[model samples]
Target: MSFTLGLIINPFAGLGGSVALKGSDGADTVARALELGAQPRAQLRALTALEALKGLTFRLITWGGDMGELVAREAGFEPEVIGRQQGAVSTAGDTETAAMAMVEAGADLILFAGGDGTARNVCATLGTSCPVLGIPAGVKIHSGVYAITPGAAGEIAAMLIRGELVALDSGEVRDIDEEAFRAGQVRARYYGELLVPSEPRYVQHVKNGAREDEALVLDDIAADFEESMESGVRYIMGSGSTVAAIMDHLGIPNTLLGVDVIEDGELIASDCTARDLLTLTQGCAARIVITPIGGQGHLIGRGNQQLSPELLNRLGRSAFHVVATKTKLKLLAGRPLLIDSGDSAVDQALSGLVAVHTGYRDQVLYRIG
Candidate 1:
């Protein structure tokens, strides 16, 4: 039996993150950015993952542009707008109103864009009864509920709808202190449970670095990270063997499989909860350096939960630094990086070419869907 699929597009998810926009939750900052020529594609960008649903038949409940309904139509799905569109709400209250309408419509799963703020709203409206997915469209998305990319979300949903056996799993729904988030100082706290499918493989678990007796050139990688420490940038280390090497440079031990946060060359927290990581980076304008989980090619939320929805907003989507050896990127051989942002909706938001850093002097463009 298929489920009733609901859709809501913030349409402004990551716009503020790059241009120093504070929030995309219908905030005035988003409006100001739009007035000053901020493009709306970031909102639409989150909708691309739905392209996978090209032939699927499920009832769609959604809001219009700024909500991303037009894009949904383009993806071959016509959705009913449950609320009166006010052009677009420029504040969090508007988002809540939209969510409330979707809930009232008896939508089963609400796939949405933006970071943790969006997640928090889903929690408020649907709680555990309604499962929600984040499309990783905003700057700082830290919760474990977002899909690493949009297509990945679609892939998982496709499997679920096809009756594939994916175990249902429940993960943390988290948020960061907004004021602290803006300053790069963060204090993340958990709100509640996010719906997960039974045996659901649609979402991915957090990833970590590989360790061997000799992790092959591990010292060299650590040395490179040591140099980065000297660069004195606040580093948001993603999961994987490459990032594990950075921990070696910091002289601090790491879990090697979870997200880590460090400031001014020292470890601020390891395997931190999204809330704690956000509090730590609240006011610090440090860059987040992450590597795709080797086989997974995820740059955002797979193994890096600290990039919670709220934190990602503060850091902005542009703050992401995807790192890998050229050899490893070849491992994917041009396959779009898989996303399991914990939320299928967020996964959809990250569906496009993104800039990833492979070395201090190297950056490669890659698709993340």
Candidate 2:
């Protein structure tokens, strides 16, 4: 049986990432991101998923222009335009209207391209009625409705359309206060929930806060890391509590939700941007220390865009040091650690087995791909 799929692309979703504004939450931020040379990838990200569903028997429903129609066409699917925007750019209201139209059109599933804000808009509109999946095209995607990667999103959607997967579950719609986020504070709140396809291997889980037990493990890992720190060497610390523990141990400030830099156990930069990282690491021997997101097993490309693929390649795999608690690793259940650095070559180069520091002088080898 053929299914009807709803597609919505938020053209300005991830505009603020590479430029380091933290999030593209409002019109002003999107405009500023463009001014700072940030290009929209929502359409390109949408295409990655749609390309995977090329031969699937489904009717595409979408909005006109950069919202969805254009991307669906670029992906070789003739989508029915069900809604229209008033001006050259689309807004949150446009997203709401499109989602509502998709529901009225009897869409079996809605596939949207955006981050947390877009997810919240769709949730506000559809609630628990229609199933939804997210293409990871935004800067901050704390929601659980998104697939692990855009390609994974397409694969899961295609399987559902082909009647290969039938189970569905309520995925949390979470968003952070971008204003507070930019000011170095994390204020994540539950927005609502959306019905999502339940495929643990494909769909990503919501990020969880650090636990009390994890804190002790982090301290041990920090002690090990500090002991191994070499003088005059730069360390680019990726965002996470595990990495934060290192900074805490040193009595230096750290960006809990943003990347930072240190040299000889001193803060060099706080809340560094991608460009800042590139400039700081130039002509310097640098190593990147990161921890995977809880439950998702993602070491890069989910929230830490400051560590761009170019930077990863420049540092090489040998320069990477991963730290995670045994509890976090157990959550993976032996699944390979994932990396979606937005560079296929880098992802391939960084794949394979790597050691993860779990405690002082204790480590475990894990595969990343």
Candidate 3:
């Protein structure tokens, strides 16, 4: 039995990441991102997944233009374009209509590329009628429907099309207020759920917020990090409450959801952009201190896009110091921490066992991929 795969690519997805707009949800934000020289990667990301399905016996169904057909063609698949796109720039309506058309066409799975907004739009149309998967091509992807990486999405899709056993589960579709997000407030709300393919190694878990009980652990980890801080050395602090605790302990103002830079116990830069970090790291000995995303165990690339792959490569693996509460690690249930820095070379280079600071004077070796 040949499986039918529906593809939807949000061309504007992840356009605001390196430029540091927090998200690309609205038309104005997308425009601004382009003005800042943000290039579309959704097509390339979708192509990465489709490359794995090159020889698979599956019928490709998608929309016209950059939504899906273009990417499918580029990836060597002659996709049957069903829905018609509006103008040059696609809108949320296009995503919704394409998804609904895919369902109507009896697609076995709907593979989409975008952030939470795209997920929400597709979920609104398909609901639980079809299984869905995301290619992780966005700035902020708190939705559980996304694969760990684009390659992983392809691998999982291949398994499904090859008649391999894969469990289906309800994946959460979440969206946050973009306005509030730009102002440093994270106000994420659950939109709904979509039936998604579940493969432990391929699919990502939903991001978990900080728990109240982790306060003491954070304090301990902060104290440990503070003690290890060297004078005259720059520290690039990645975003998260865990990293925020380090700044709080030093009485330095920090961006709770943005990357910051510190030098010799002084705030050099707050809420630094990727360009800012790249500029700061030139000829300076800098070390990165980051905490994994709760539940998902992602050390980089989820929320902290400011720490781009170039920055990570410049710093090398030795300059990284991973910190997490015991509770966060426990939530992984033996799953290794993940890293999707948008650079496969960097991702592979950083993969392996790394030490994670759990608490004061405590550490554990965890795998990073």
Candidate 4:
């Protein structure tokens, strides 16, 4: 029998990201994100993975409309439409229903696109009964079920369709309290596990939840950044606790999981969107301060999706300033920093050796890939 691949797309996933809403979990947040002009990219992300399967022979099944059918057709696949979405916008209940339908349809593997919330929904519907793979499309991707990038997820799914000997392992589904996350407090909870293809190179590891106890190290790094601030330059502060230290040093409120703009030692904007940054830094000297995810080592395309490619290209590679503690770099174990900006050319342009601020008056050369 031919392999049957089930597909699901959380259409609203990651919609709140570029708008700096932290996550697209609740209806209110999704509506607010739309009001803020946040564009939906989950369909595009799913299409990226589906396009990689061109000429591959497999039976595809998915939910109707933006959930999966539309993107599947765009990828030239005649997907068997299973269920119709409940309303104008699909809800978490729709996602759960789709998973159940896929399982009942005898799907060999399920491929889903979303963040940790989508992973949780699928896990709740069909635990370890079917092997699944995640295409990263959400803002809060603290879960271990997602691939490092959308294309990587496609490559792994292609492997399974070819009947290759792929190992299936349990990946944890984790979600954070968006309320706490927005308030600069991270509280992640373990929900459940799902059976997933074990491809360490492609699949992302769960984010490190342990708090950084090295307060003195953060102070030193923050001090180094504080010393480097120039007169007319706008600094784009990316998300993460490491970067938050600099904001703390400046006595400014940090968004914790959102982008902020600093200019002349003043908080110009907090929780900025991609469009907001573009407007603020247009025709102005600007620099970006970023830190890689602790366990994933992703410098972009993880949480800081607000750092869109256009802004990065406008600022150029020289405008990027990386900051991380030596311990964080050691955790990568020599893996080059990763970039999945959703633009291949941009990711290529940003790849090279760069100086990383390790501490006060300290730096080291590192590779960004």
Leading candidate by TM-score: 3
Which rank order by TM-score, best down to worst?
A: 3, 4, 2, 1
Off by over 4 Å in 1: 20-28, 35-38, 86-90, 198-201, 204-369
Each prediction's RMSD over C-alphas, in Å, is 10.4, 1.8, 1.3, 1.4
Candidate 4 colliding pairs:
none
Tell me the whole-model lDDT of each prediction, alpha carbons only.
0.62, 0.88, 0.89, 0.91
Q: Which parts of model 3 have CA positions greater than 4 angstroms off?
A: none
Order of models, best lDDT first: 4, 3, 2, 1
Per-residue alpha-carbon lDDT of model 1 for 1-369, expressed as tens digits?
456676766666665543334445546667776775555544544556786666777777777665757777777777787764665353455567777787788776677777777777777766777667766666555566766566656666666556566665565676666566554344667788677653323453322223345454455555555664535457777655677676765677665545677776677776655556677777776667777755446676432544655666566556666666766777665656764444444555656777765555456788877
Shift in Å, residue 264, candidate 4: 1.8
lDDT of 2 by residue, 1-369 (tens): 579999999999888887778899888998898898777878888888897898778888999999998888888888899889877789999999999999999999999999999999999999989999999988888899999888889998899888884689999999999999887777999999999999888888897755755677788999999999999889999888888888899898988888889998789998887889999999999999999988789898877877888899999889989999889999888877888776767888999999999999999999996
Relative to the unseen true structure, what is the C-alpha lDDT of residue 210 in candidate 4, on a scale of 0 to 100? 71
Q: After superposition, how far is residue 278 of candidate 3 from its true place, in Å?
A: 1.1
* Number of clashes found in candidate 4: 0
Off by over 4 Å in 2: none
For TM-score, candidate 3 versus 4, the one ahead is 3
Per-residue lDDT tens digits of candidate 4, residues 154-269?
99989989988889899999999988888878899999999999988788889876777889999999999999999999999999999998899889888888899989888999
Q: Clashes in candidate 2: how many?
A: 0
